[model samples]
Target: MTSAALSFRYVGDSGMDETMNQQLLIDNGLPNSLAPVLSFKALDETHHVLPDVKVSTVFGSDRGNLVVPYGGSYDILRFSGPGKHDVTDVRVTVQRKTEARNPAGSHDVTTQALDSHGRAIEKFERFSAVRLINEDNFPVFVRIAYILWDQPPKGVTQQAVEVTPIGGLTSVPAHGTAVVKVSGKAAAAVARNSYGPAVSIKAYNSQ
Candidate 1:
């Protein structure tokens, strides 16, 4: 922990989860300015990068709190992205099959689509999430958690999915990749972030 480690959440799946009774614990030592991008992978003792066990990154920002469990290093790439900044923490969120969700935190904006002129053209309300589909012959279990918010989507119908997280750089065994769904728009009311975008969009004017 560093000098900036004052604010963080700690609500474990605490008693509801099992103890991995393993050696080599992994701790999050990043400064408050940065957080783990997404979950991580853990391999088996054989040191076989191709085939091994897996452990997920920490749970929600409320839970695990950036610190990982018995396994290798955390996945910094998932937490840090090109366009994403000013994030406290990040985690992979999934729900029951086929239900579009909302952004759990302020950082959970679905990546907006851009036209030739680099303009956003989304109609319905959009939220970002990580979706994983199994395309392999065997069943693969992934460890993931809900978004930063404990509250369910205000008016959407959905259920949570239980996954088995993996540690190490690679996942245990799965034929899939992380497909993110996030979106962001200028908050007209906020003077700092939206002044430029809102002006061009004609949504609001400082004059």
Candidate 2:
């Protein structure tokens, strides 16, 4: 099966909409890690990534850091056929909220590539996972660009998803617990709470 684009969906949040707010930026001006070791671009001249290391997101689910695409069902996005040219690659910008300093919020996300073709690219590339790492005291309100699921999600908007704008800062935060793999071109970076606006996530048809 092949998925076009994917977003997140929350099942049990009272007084709040089921779909979580996210600022999606998919398949637009991003690098692909599956482009072979000699061809794949380096993160930066100064920054470097380690091999076979794991980072924890402390997510509140069984799938851990992969809460976005996998949710709580399974791991890996079983893919079949299709070459490298037919894939959608993008980065998951994780914005952390820094209440004390910036009031708006800050984010600690990675500079990794997420594949939307519903297939893993040698474990370095992500298809069914959006890894988040929060090094803050308070929990972060996740607003990822999208989700690439292992299986087609049920009872969702299907067409596209709309997220509510956070007024001043709500008590309700995004889901937690994610395990990030620190390998290949994967590295960490920080972004302010300038998530701009919550964009609509058009559901991808897994053909």
Candidate 3:
């Protein structure tokens, strides 16, 4: 912990006057111009190249995961596209099985048409979202994360998936390739629960 300390200096005319001026300055609790300086730097190549961090609003997806004792309730939803263009306009659609009986009451489909990159493109004209569909009547929890790699190697890490958003989407430069994956749990608690297992979207903005 750091604390401020009282400092005195010679001020004004002669011995007595200088002593009094110094005392006055000290008593006033004034800050000294000569203070310690603090600074920092990027540790390595990775941190240095990354861009500022930003967050995006959560959205829904159609991807579904199987429920088993050890298998888990979440499944992997993959998104692949050309890294050459800025990826946007995602729409999540959740479709429940049509039993031809309970029509309206059997589905819980919500829409967030708002684009993730609204500020960059004004007028709300540019919009994107993902789609979500429930095939086995199981509500799925999908969380997507991303990362940007300038020259990603053609191997496991290149196409690896994670439960958390990977890479730096906000910091992802133009034409840079990024691998984003979703991971979460999904299960219907009540047998009569119509909305299925509710899933929440958590988005991080990487500026």
Q: Per-residue lDDT of 1-207 in model 2, one digit per residue for the tens?
A: 112222222221122553432112112111211110001111112334222222111121112222221111111111123321121221222332111211111333332323455333322232333444444454533333232222224432121122111111112123343433222222221111113322221111010
Residue 2 error, candidate 2, Å: 45
lDDT score for residue 201 of model 1: 13
Candidate-wise lDDT, in order:
0.24, 0.23, 0.21
Off by over 4 Å in 2: 1-104, 111-126, 146-207
Q: Write the per-residue lDDT of candidate 1 for residues 69-90, one digit (tens) a residue.
A: 1121222111223322222222
Report the C-alpha lDDT of model 3 over 48-112, residue by residue, as the tens digit.
31122111211111211111111111122223433311221122122321111111112222222
TM-score between model 1 and native:
0.19
Instruction: Provide backbone clash counts, one per model.
Output: 27, 18, 35
Specify the highest-lDDT model's number: 1
Candidate 2: C-alpha lDDT = 0.23
